[model samples]
Target: MTRHYLRNASIDQPLNVLVATPAGGTGQGGIDRIMAALKAELERRPNGVIARFAPTRGKGALALSLFHLTHFCARIAAWRLQRRLDLVHINLSSRGSTYRKIVIAACARMMRVPYVIHLHGSEFRSFWSNSSPIVDRSIHALFEKASRIIVLGTPWQAFIAERVPNAHGRIVIVPNAVEEPRVAHVGGGASVHILFLGRISDRKGVPHLVKALARMKDVPGWRATLAGDGAVDDLKSEITALGLADRVTVPGWLGPEETARLLATGDILTLPSHAENLPMSIIEAMASGLGVVATPVGAVEDIVKDGKTGLLVPPGDDSALADALSRLVQDGELRQRLGAAAQAFQRRHLSIGPYADRICAVWQDAAAAHRGEASLPALVTPTDLKA
Candidate 1:
């Protein structure tokens, strides 16, 4: 389908966009943070876009979660009846998230409202490949119903294109972004501080991170903080067993303000995950001008260029992780160089300013496509918009 671009569309009123996600701003997950950041950025701009946070899933019992999902579907019907809804932005993940979104998308379609699906699940491929044929068809039908399918990276774009061949033309790459850190980056005084901000689980390679840090016990000038929830007790036990009890601290979880403070004070941000969909921690670290040491999983390599913006170690490689950490801790100049480059890359591409513009364009374009007004809006670059 050829998408028409409307050069001058009347935009006196803001677009009412219903964004369905796990938990908008209050949730601790990466997708929640992304939507929260986007919502906040959109609020800051008078760009004629109003996003309503319609949280479909929450950190509650199964019954409560189901209630929220049902409520979200009903709310969509109600909003459409009131003629207040312009588009439904469905933030989807793997497994249960996909199931919930299928129902939500179906409801939105029944109400004749266009919806976009933003894929954020890291283990989606594994989940989708293992699903039954009936489930696969339902998933395919969900994609077929979407106005657009937003992916975090190019690899994901390919993945979705291969799975839903007909929806290939609708796939778009919109990497996770963060607002410029309000707190400035400052070195961790004498001993370099390494920060790990995510779930404290095996998928995140936290065990490997502890083992790597243990190898650096003989080396000095480094302290680590693994600040996140999940398997916290297990991680603590491992840290003690590795004799890194004194050097490594396992704080359960940090809120946004605390996270910002930690990001500002830390010298290096590390996430040795086995899988990811462009982890947001790296983006936040880059925005804070912290040297990043992460595994090249999913779309990590898209922004974290090895030896340039950040160092990439193979997944589950304790030795390489230790080597990367030791290198950054020992060489302050290298840290500064990498941190500066990462920060520059973030400002140019991953900052919330341009991110908000691109998202707004997608929402506008999706809305237009639903109304059969014209083709997708011309996605203007930041420079192009300024000009």
Candidate 2:
């Protein structure tokens, strides 16, 4: 099928682009929400950086891989006919994400389309280092070939610069944007509600949180809600064993509305994760006017100033975590103070509109660079449009 193009037409239209990522689900994780928000924003913007979404992963591993391959092949098939695509925006993380995207990057290269890789996973550094030698080399090669590699925070940017030195010049920092609240949250009960949102797993420091709550058992008038799924049985068992079952409730996963309600109830939002890359829970907590008690891992310190916007403790230090939580639990005035600061910070800096605008700029820049490398004609599109 020979699709028509705007050949020699007015240079008003920006280059066509496609975003390839794992999508299509009801609030699966951070990446899904981010992509959905960006897609909505891109559509709203009038001129420059039009986009198409190609979902790569779905359910099962085998099915997901096959779907991704077919999607890439379809794009290549279209390229043969129209050459309409100017950039291949690839969203990635680590492990299988890197593996699949490396292949997709190859396909994009074969199609002569420039590609950009957006890193999302919290444990990406470990993923890169722990992978087999062959996989590591392939990962580096993919990073090197990308026109731009966007990471969530300065921590990741530094990680890539030191770890993937070949991608030093091309790495960019764009933090994750979240639109959510805590669900399964009941409030107005005159109890300090400390909320922990995210996966209930070892990596997320669920055990450490249970221990912290156990430490706070003697502290008066405070309850904790642990939301999200992953190792729920172990988390519940740990809570029971530590005699925190009365004060702590583990609500496996929550919908957006429930999450929002729960976030609204929070006096303090806490996540003592051992590793992270700007976790969406903290951003949402900040947005919801809740004081945050988190470890200074990933970009937690980037947005959260100690004792200003939020409180930070060392990861895996249950005692420090307890002490931090205890401080917030005891001082209602301080909680309100920090929560106000957090909300202000989020509204001013971490809102989705600004995030989308920044991403729009990145897409535009990547497309422009592709034009430069290919010596293609420049698009005379007007700037100043907010994405």
Candidate 3:
């Protein structure tokens, strides 16, 4: 689809950008939530920036391959037709993500548009460390040419600096943010609803969470709900094997409204993930005022305060995971205190407005460097964009 509203090369023009992400809100994972939220936030006020969202990937291998071909044509059309095109913000993950964005980056470079890579992968270092030399070079080349690399946390900032030492200076840390709910989760309900929302795989520690809860059958007024797709039959088998069918509810997968309702009703959210890079489940749980009980992995350690805003356990430790949830289950006051603190932490620090502000500045810097401009007009402050 070719779209051209008004072509303006004048000094006064919005910083136009093309944001390339996956087909979000389409039964995808954390990165999709982050993309949907950030895109909406930027598009909300859009002070002087006209942003265009172009989805790149879909379900399955063939769809993903086709999406690349389809989006490439759309990107070319936008570049050819739009006069105020400034930058391309590419949201990327590990493995296939880097592999795919390499093509997008090359396309951006061909059109002489500055492109930025926003890393959302939880295991990029693992992917980078284990890849063949040829693949590593391709990854390096992609990051090396990018105008900047946006990381989720300082840990990622440092990791990427070491990963692509050549472009270390281009790394920018922008933690994930979610819109706060109007009404927070009512904690300390009659029954403690422990929620685990994510892909039901061993990597996400679904069995571990079920194992933990299976042992806690004696914990009064404590029930658990497992939401999300992937290995659902396997997870159901495991839950059945543990005799937790009565204690746990595996809902398979949830849409946005169902997910929101679950989060809003959940008192304690647990993610004993084997690994993560600031998963949006934890972020959204924090926003909804749920007392978070998660493993200290990735940016989770940075966002969740141990014993304060939320409790953090060592990854892959079922005993610790169970004990953390037990603590919340036993003490209703503790749940309220922690949930309130978690909500406050999210609003005070990780709101979407500041995240959008950082992206706006990054877009401006990328465009200015490419076009030899002095600076952006600084038209929209974070305060003005605050929700």
CA lDDT of each prediction against the hidden true structure = 0.85, 0.76, 0.77
Superposing all C-alpha atoms, what RMSD in Å does each candidate have to the true structure? 3.6, 5.7, 4.9
lDDT of 1 by residue, 1-387 (tens): 112222225565678989998975554688888888888876775677778896788767766889899889998999889989989999989988999998998899899999999899998988889999999998989888899888888778889899989988777788788987868877688899999999998999988988899889999889999999999998888888888899999989888888998998899999999999989889999998899999998888888889899999999999999999999999999999999999888888887777777777778878877777675534722222110
- Per-model TM values vs. the true structure: 0.94, 0.88, 0.90
Please report, as a residue range, the 10-residue window in candidate 1 with the lowest summed lDDT. 378-387
- Per-residue lDDT tens digits of candidate 3, residues 289-380? 88999988787877888988889888877888888999999888998899889888888768877776677677766677677765433422
Leading candidate by TM-score: 1
Q: How far is candidate 2 from the true structure (C-alpha RMSD, Å)?
A: 5.7
Distance (Å) between predicted and true CA of 67, model 3? 4.0
Q: Once model 3 is optimally superposed onto the true structure by TM-score, how far is the C-alpha of residue 312 displaced, in angstroms?
A: 1.0
lDDT of 2 by residue, 129-192 (tens): 8888898888888888888778877778888788778778677677777643435334436888
Please give the lDDT score at residue 28 for candidate 3.
Answer: 56
| Residue 102 CA displacement from its true place in model 1, Å | 0.9
Error of 1 at 112 (Å): 1.2
Off by over 4 Å in 2: 1-11, 60-62, 180-188, 373-387
TM-score order of candidates, top first: 1, 3, 2
TM-score of 2: 0.88
